[model samples]
Target: MVILLNCAHHVTQRLQKTFVNYGEAMMYSLESCPSPWLRTHSMWGRYTVSFMLIVTQLGFCSVYFMFMADNLQQIVEEARTTSNTCQPRQILVLGPILDIRFYMLSILPFLVLMVLIQNLRVLSIFSTLASVTTLGSMALIFEYIIQGIPHPGNLPLVANWKTFLLFFGAAIFAFEGVGMVLPLKNQMKNPQKFSFVLYLGMSLVISLYICLGTLGYMKFGSDTRASITLNLPNCWLYQSVKLMYSVGIFFTYVLQFHVPAEIIIPFALSHVSESWALFVDLTVRTALVCLTCVLAVLIPRLDLVISLVGSVSSSALALIIPPLLEITTFYSEDISFVTIAKDVLISILGLLGCIFGTYQALYELTQHNFYSRVNFTGGIHV
Candidate 1:
């Protein structure tokens, strides 16, 4: 598995570099060439990429809602209970009548933010904020991990097999974001320099991932919360860390939503009556956000949600689909079956991983409820 992931990572990194060279329209867009297993016989090329984009983005939106709701609810309850303040109105959502502790404080405000910022000039400022806050929060996390690592908390040196599956899902979830590469590369001012930038950038990302994963797992061990931020001591300093990270994530949420909106809005606008286009756009956007909120409420465990989404979607996005894209996009009569077989084998392993990891996640989630509305903020950290 280690070897497989390493190969996949290198392949994905290299493919992304290749995608930079593919010019404006990525070649893997949908087609209906029918076939039994491979070739232009089926819509495999198109559907794989499309499915990854939609499913992964949906997972992202759900995660955003979950993160926002849980963190906001945590602070709100802490504040309201201690001070006996905040007499907010009740809003009933899907049989749950939430009091002051609800997603409206998180989701609704952000819904407004989404509607407000359409101009790139205005949005770029928040993007900068997102970058800065993400870095700042990461630095704080490293500090916390470094301080805690020496204490050697009651963490296992290795996980049991069952638990390790969850770790697989979560690890991929943390590292997965390769889908954005082509668009970013395509928009770059210096396309030739992108290789240097991609390498330097991904190296730093891997370093941070390694440091956080190793140190965080070591430091928190069995005590780690859904997020490392949650493992921080509940003081003003650490609480501020959660909030700062939330701010970064919150800003990025809009950016994430923008892609899906662009995909969905034009389609809706084209179909609806000219007079009703604006109304349809607003309605569709609201419904999309609401759908994510519903999913978050339905499955409150942030770690499980992340893992499940990772297993179900990120596995393909990061592992399976890219290799297939390479096979179809770059292959010809000259390409050896051995090389093709190697690529096919990597994809097969990715598929197996996706299926196994997804089953493992669903099994864990179902252990709690078949479909019960468990409190979103109540899950113990992994």
Candidate 2:
């Protein structure tokens, strides 16, 4: 916790200095630095970031795809008879599409739509709806969680130690919004208060995570879905919640997806003729989205991808990169033992997380074990 917070502050300061000292023009991303390696410039290091960014963004897209598909699948399955109190079976609106087929087919419309939008940032106008609908769905989930507190069925005080790394990775994935920090800070009306804003914002976010994680696990116990939203009852109101949440995520997808897509474009465009550039670029973007969807289908397990990406990328971005950047930017020579030890320790933790968490997630994926622990029914491999 100490290292994480310190890294956040240091990274913020580092970013501010980067904007001022390195000139704002050079700093294209939170991940960018003149010295990609330790006190030395290396194209290899830069490409490493690019590679991680590519994988990270693709993972995010897969998550969004899985999320939408899962919710729709839940709605369809539950429409038959998933609720208590003996309510009438609800109608399945989308007809008799196989769950996996729907997952793959549904992505096509978005893929085509994404290609049509020349200006990706234009989706920023929808950020308001994203925020509102996300919070609204969260509110509904929290209400369910709170109500479940009185009768939490066989809640465990201590989960298995092996699962700790998985949860650690997942938590990092969940907390990731640091990429937007620089932009949000830059756009603030009074940029001076950005630190306070960051701290306060992070505090609220952490509190919310604690509440959700605690209440959710307490309520659902071992039956907790990858997303708390999926645990909601199969009814008109809850189904509406899932739909609204999915829509919000749908719009937000293009927003996050645009960055890596933009980063890849310049390199891709350089190879094509001026007249064919637009067509080729669109082709590349479409292919990337398709690849992401394919990955989602293969590893339909939401837990695996979220944990793997978080363990693989989030750990490096949040814990490893910032510390190294700090060392490079601040101390050219004669760094202290304390500083060296801190970074090395944090980096090791990050590495252990990435290695183990990724292994666990991948192993689970190979076993086709997306099913909840208590309800494992030998899931079909993709």
Candidate 3:
């Protein structure tokens, strides 16, 4: 309910800004475009898109629920076999590393393709949606996960590795919005207006995440797993809510999937025969989608994927590429101490995060393999 209200408020704010900047003229243009078909179309297109996005969220929620349940059950079963205990392991410390890698692999190609394609409007929309949704959802998920966990005092362990990974991944995802900033910077009627919108949007997103995360951790505490869908309770009301949340997640992923494909198709086929290129592009896009889906199913570890995304793709695209692009494009500007300091800070942070995440992932993998080996040897002894 709060999430819904916040979303409404955010949209309203954006629309109000647009109205102030462009006046009724922008609305008129949308309504009275040159083509009759375009002009006649109702706001149905927007509503339809919203509805589809909701459904997509539900799909992702369902997948998350299934995956989380299976993961928890697997852990329980393993514990029973090994020690007859159902308590969760401190496995999350390693989980972030895998997440960083997976996300990097998934996003790198897509980000590159977007840069090459240079469709500013679409990129702006995609970036905004990715960042805002990722941040908002993180808060909601964290709130849900920690709903029932007990904490004795004010300064209780505010964050665990799992929580940290979840929030960090979200923060990284939030930077996706930065991609939209540059493109839209030139499009605004007043370039100065850009800073207002950019800062306002980011501040709102960060606030929302903090609120949601704090509430969620307070509620679910240490036992909270799967920061998104699985964190929520299983009552009918929650189930219904979960359905909506799931649909939202599905739409988010679908959008993420489509953005890269759309950008890549044109570039990948730039040199080919038009007809043949279109066919090839479609084939490649479809294959990529299938492969990602397969990997999601096989891996089914959201934490690992999130960490991988932050460490690799997010690091490269969000941290490295932006600064490089800025340096090359804006080289004429005199370099102030402030500008140099900010750039240096951002680069160092991004690099450290990536390295830390990668190390964690490799360490976890080694641990898992070693445990498996020990078990095999014990079995032989038996």
Candidate 4:
């Protein structure tokens, strides 16, 4: 009887243990089961939201680029046709100071774009190169025009090949954003290997600039317009090139416009709905782009604008800002006096260029009406 009781007790204990283990297993199974329908629906909803967001952003970029195509073409066409003597009335009216303002204005979009975009390196490289190409072409054209001037005040300044070289060098100084490669240097996948790549890229750009400037100068002499596009031989080849250039310019500017709006939208969203913020941001950006395009189209003279931008806007940003930032930030480091001196010299050159170039443009503007004036003799004057 006692043995039976012991067996029964043992069985009871075993049953209790089994019951506890089963309960724990059941709980674990319940916890580990696939999510409920509501949970799955919520997760899918989030993914859908994310996908839609990405699609919307991409769609916006596409539409924006499409809208800018015509304007880009026009800019290219203008660049191709722009004479060495071309000057914009706005530059004349605004003066060098205004050039600085406009330069700042142009930069605003770039900065905004950088902040908004994911792949900034590509965008930056493209925009910088485009600007450089445009400006370089303008410089070549300007050189041609300056050479053509019968009694240019600074005739001796550009008379000899040596002086011409110096002038070209100065123009290149205005083309200074090549320093952008510096900031991007460390970002490369293999930074050490990139030195060769960077050097090669820069060499190619320098070579291209020299070739274009030399050819342009040879073709147009002193009468070369501000844009090399104008200097292009009016052959099928040239026309095709011009069309391509125009397309590039259009895309560059469109990207420029899109960048600012996209960046500002996020900031604006603090006070407004995402959609409304985007709308307002884009509206403002579009207005600015339209205004710039109108001015560029109406002004038509590439040289004057180029000179204005070169001397004032590009100079300040390219020459002034980087050195200043570098000095201020890296002052404690082993910076050389030579570097400081160089920065000062660059800044001075930029300032002088801005003043002199604007003066030239304004002097020209004052001498002639952009629109044809009718003479009393019933003849139209251009």
TM-score winner among the candidates? 2
Q: Residue 7 of candidate 4: its Cα lDDT?
A: 22
* Per-residue C-alpha lDDT of model 1 across residues 38-58, encoded as one tens digit per residue: 534344444445556667776
- Which stretches of candidate 2 lie above 4 Å from their native place? 1-41, 80-97, 115-121, 151-153, 183-197, 333-337, 369-382
Model 4 is weakest, by summed lDDT over 10 consecutive residues, at 373-382
Compared with the true structure, model 1 gives a TM-score of 0.78
Give the distance in Å from residue 307's predicted Cα in candidate 2 to where it truly belongs: 1.0
Clashing pairs in 2: none
Q: List the RMSD of every prediction in angstroms.
A: 7.0, 5.7, 14.7, 22.7
Sorted by lDDT (best first), the order is 2, 1, 3, 4
TM-score of each: 0.78, 0.80, 0.55, 0.50
lDDT of 4 by residue, 61-121 (tens): 3222322332233344345444544342111111122221233244335434432443555
Clashing pairs in 1: 33-41, 33-42, 34-41, 35-41, 35-42
For all candidates, what are the clash counts? 5, 0, 34, 15
Better of 1 and 3 by TM-score: 1
Off by over 4 Å in 1: 1-44, 80-101, 115-122, 148-154, 336-338, 369-382
Q: For model 3, what is the error of residue 269's alpha carbon versus the real structure, in angstroms, after optimal superposition?
A: 1.8
Cα lDDT tens digits, model 3, 128-218, are: 6655555564554554445455574653554556435434543564444332233355456675565567668768867866666555555
Worst 10 residues of 3 by lDDT: 373-382
